[model samples]
Target: MRFEKENWDVIIVGTGPAGACLAREISKQHKKVLLLEKGQADLSINIPRMLKNNEMMFIGNGKTLVRGIRSGGTSVLYYGTAYDPPEELFSKFGIDLASEVEELRRELPLAPLKDELIGPAAQKIRESAVSLGYAWEKLDKFIYQDMCTPGYFPFDAQWNATRYVNDAINSGAVLLTNSEVTKVIVNGKQAVGVEAIVQGERHKLFASQIVLSAGGLGTAQILQASKINKAGEGFFCDPITIVQGLAEGIEAGNEIPMAAGMMFKNEGFILTDLTLPKLVYQLFSFQALRPHRVWQHRRTIGIMVKVRDGIGGSIKRGKVHKVFSEADKLKMQQGESKAREILQHAGAKRLYSTVWTSAHPGGTARIGEVVDPNLKSEYDNLYVCDCSVIPTEWGLPPTLAVLALAKRLAKHLLLRSYHRR
Candidate 1:
């Protein structure tokens, strides 16, 4: 492979929350860091841009999917709902994120949306859930209220990977945009560099440490390309369905999605408010074959049933092959039933879930199997610290947990001796 002129102390792949967080942390130690991004830089993250770009959306066999392919990754286009990863799972891997999570709690804007910020439809849904004794409560978010304007500008006011990317750059990290890393280059079981295509040209970058934080699918594919065993086996993506309803008089137009929800942890599902931006609402309406409903989008109310599913999947030829188990199907049905009950209570009619789609893909390359406790892979100096490292399907957004995991990994890699293969 051809080599670049510069050598880095650490080369991080993918600029998502996990990758960005880790890069910034390492750069703070004055290391020569390089961040490689698959997508182009300077791509504005907004509803319109997302709607127009085909590359931004990676759909797998019309089942699993992910969006927001750019310098900041999906964090740039998120709805802001956040959930903490189950601590026990990480503990089993000999890692803890409590301290890091605490630090972020104080730094990031993380709180439940205020009553004034909740939309009328969602408010009614919350009331109905409370009346039914489901213990539905406000969901934590990563948004700064004062930074947000009155309208539905999805790109602005949210805490995204871009902030950390900038922080890493300011702290002396070099970033290569449009550099799609295909695989880790291992020299006789020792990973020392990566081969990537940068703006139509192939380039090889060497580093003392190589970290892959390219979400589940991206990381899995990269590992497979390097002939890593079981790259995506035993992976899972939360099965989800959005139950749409029309609130008679309430205007839920372009409100924040997943404002509040009830969690039935043991039952493995959540009934949450699912409001979309105005244009996205119309797209959903059309996809539902209800073009007539476009006029009533302002009065539209939505309830999403996001449930954890059993882990069983394979990634071959850049595609994901997975099916929902009977247990998962049962949970989806239960969630739909609960959502319908709440929508009915809110005076909403014609309740229906648009379609079944998989949530963020993860657990592809697991902690105990693909990577060790320190997130180091089988090849020396190769590490993975993204959704791909998660060992279970928690059925929650992974930013907070992923960010903390990166911080923990950075500390471990610095404080401990590297395990040479």
Candidate 2:
């Protein structure tokens, strides 16, 4: 592979926020970079279309968890929700991202949504939560308001990693889609390169630096497959469920989903109003055995509750062997109850819940335990800069935090390259 040449400085094994940001940043230094994505490069930013086509979305193990597998990774499916990282968490890794975080906030379109963008369902949810004494508020997002309309587009208004991928490509970085990395090629505790499968063929690519940003589960699966035996253990997947109800006199065809929510930090959960597109709404409604509610798609309002689960699981053959504990069940129950109450207060009836599923999964390869503070593993030049590096439970969206953290990792990689040269 061309990456085997001495001119190739780095190879990133993902197109998600971490890898995308890193490639874009490193390419600015005129370094030869290679970005590999396991999925296709076709942009499937239209939510309704992707839902109908049943492509780009990967739901494994009876819908236990779902993720987007595409050039932009899950960010293509994301609603751009933003949150400040628990800086203290990275402090344990002896890294401070205050400046990086601030820089990204300025660079990206992170802001609280305007009132016009807040759907009626979200307003009702916020009012109910406030009346119930919960501090409900609008969440910031990485949205370009100028391009953001209610409907979805192929290259929707979302601030996806694809933009960064494009920038990297324009800066002379090479990107290969549909190249699934199977393992990192290690030479006696030193990562010299990686081996991947492309179109059912094997290929070897050598690089001075190898950065793994293939998400949490994706990264863990790769590590375990690479003979890093302990890499897949001790993972968590914020066990979650969506409490939904049919609200009378509410129409949400053009409503932006996930705009407002109540963060019950101490209560160990969050409640967000999940507005849905009509087609997507009907599918969930039918599968939930509420086929009778299918026609009322525009009137459906949902509240999603996600709680931190104990990190204890193993990933084998790309499947997560994890289950909800008794304590996790209790937290789910508590959160579901609150969500139902808010829906009821908002004049919603015929309440129901989707089976528990995880949106974010992480902590598989931790900072202090599995990797060092520099995000380097037990092996040399093998770094991990994704959710897998998160050492503890995190209840928020990780896109923003991952992008900032990648900047820190990119700085380290660049400095190391300089010293070596």
Candidate 3:
């Protein structure tokens, strides 16, 4: 790979939540930062179209799961559920979310979906949760609420990672799109730079610090290319299954709030609405429909069961291999049972379960496994900042948590640079 003398203070590997947040923070200090994204910078608000083409959507591996690959990364396709991290996980990493909560709130505030915005199907799911004694709450979303109009549903509420990417760029960080990092360049135990292929041409970027936010699969691929075997071990995505139930009175094509409410179980599992794009809905309907009665159900409600599994998966060469233990399977079954109960309460006629996959994969390059307490890889100056750095299965949406961790990591790097100064 040819070298460029345009050195950067920090070179971020992915333009997802962590990278964008870190870039925004570092650029505030007027530091030279280079953010490399593997895909194009398209921020279209059309969820159905994006889902169809698998362009900006999280289409799991052709076999089982759906993962995102684009400039905004998975956030561009995920249900915009902004969640708080598990306090216990952060304490283990010496991260203080309280210190950053105020700032986080300012950036990403949680607002309940208005009743008019949530369709009858979603409301039914909520009602079911309440009936079962399971606590259900409206989810906090990171969205530009005004853009979301009634009847537009998920389109109105989803704030893709492009928002943060644009913020980083506007804050003066240089963003290089369609740049896929293939190798982490290490020199005698200290990380020096990365070699990436942009437009089929290889380019090497050197930086004082490197943050890997290339997502669970991408990060694992980079580590494998760099001979970092520990990166993909213990990877866990909130393995989710969508249960579809036929709802009466609701139109089949009616729009529902992408994710209006959540039911967090005491067993570390969460049952929430699976707000799907039209294509996903069609697929689920096709699968759930019986052999002779494909059109029997006019309305469908989806509930996602995110199980807390003791057995996690691993990402190897951009593929996820999940090992569901008996206990994990049992937990998933229990979650499904609860979800069915909710749907039944909600006046669902026929119930069915879709295949399980995960978009929130974490713990690949977990703390103490691939990185240390400070998120530093074995090679100095190399850091993994995305969900891959999560030491345990967080059992929740990890975008907010990843951003907070990135902020702390950036602060740590800044302090280290200050001491060197």
* TM-scores of all candidate predictions against the true structure: 0.93, 0.93, 0.90
Better of 1 and 3 by TM-score: 1
Sorted by lDDT (best first), the order is 2, 1, 3
Give the candidates in order of TM-score, highest first.
Answer: 2, 1, 3
Q: State how far residue 411 of model 1 sits from its true place (Å).
A: 1.0
Compare candidates 2 and 3 on TM-score and give the better one. 2
| Every candidate's lDDT | 0.81, 0.81, 0.74
Query: Once all C-alphas are superposed, what RMSD does model 2 give against the true structure?
Result: 2.6
> How many Å off is the CA of 68 in candidate 3?
1.8
The total number of steric clashes, by the backbone 3 Å criterion, in model 1 comes to 0
**lDDT by residue (tens digit), candidate 2, 1-421:** 5444444689899998889999999999989899988888866456555554333233444555656667888787777888888878788667898999998988898897787777778888988988988878899978887775444322456688999999999999999888889999999999988888865678888888999989888898888877877787877777667888878787765677788887777767777888766666776666677788888777778898888777876777865677667887788899999999999998898899977667667888888888888899988999999888988877778888889889999999999999997
* TM-score of candidate 1 to 2 decimals: 0.93
lDDT of 3 by residue, 298-383 (tens): 46677888876553656666555776667767778988988888888888876888766666667888887888888898889999
Instruction: Give lDDT tens digits, candidate 1, residues 1-421.
Output: 2338778889999998899998899998888899999887754645556646533343444453545568888787677878887888788777778899998888788998877777777888889888987788999989886765444435566788889999999999989887889989999989989999987898888998999998888899999999896778867777777888877767667666788998888889877898867676776677668788878777788888988888886777776677677898899999899999988887888876775666567898898889888888899889999888888776878899999989888887766433432
Cα misplacement distance, residue 114 of candidate 1 (Å): 1.9
Q: List the residue pairs that clash in candidate 2.
A: none
lDDT of 2: 0.81
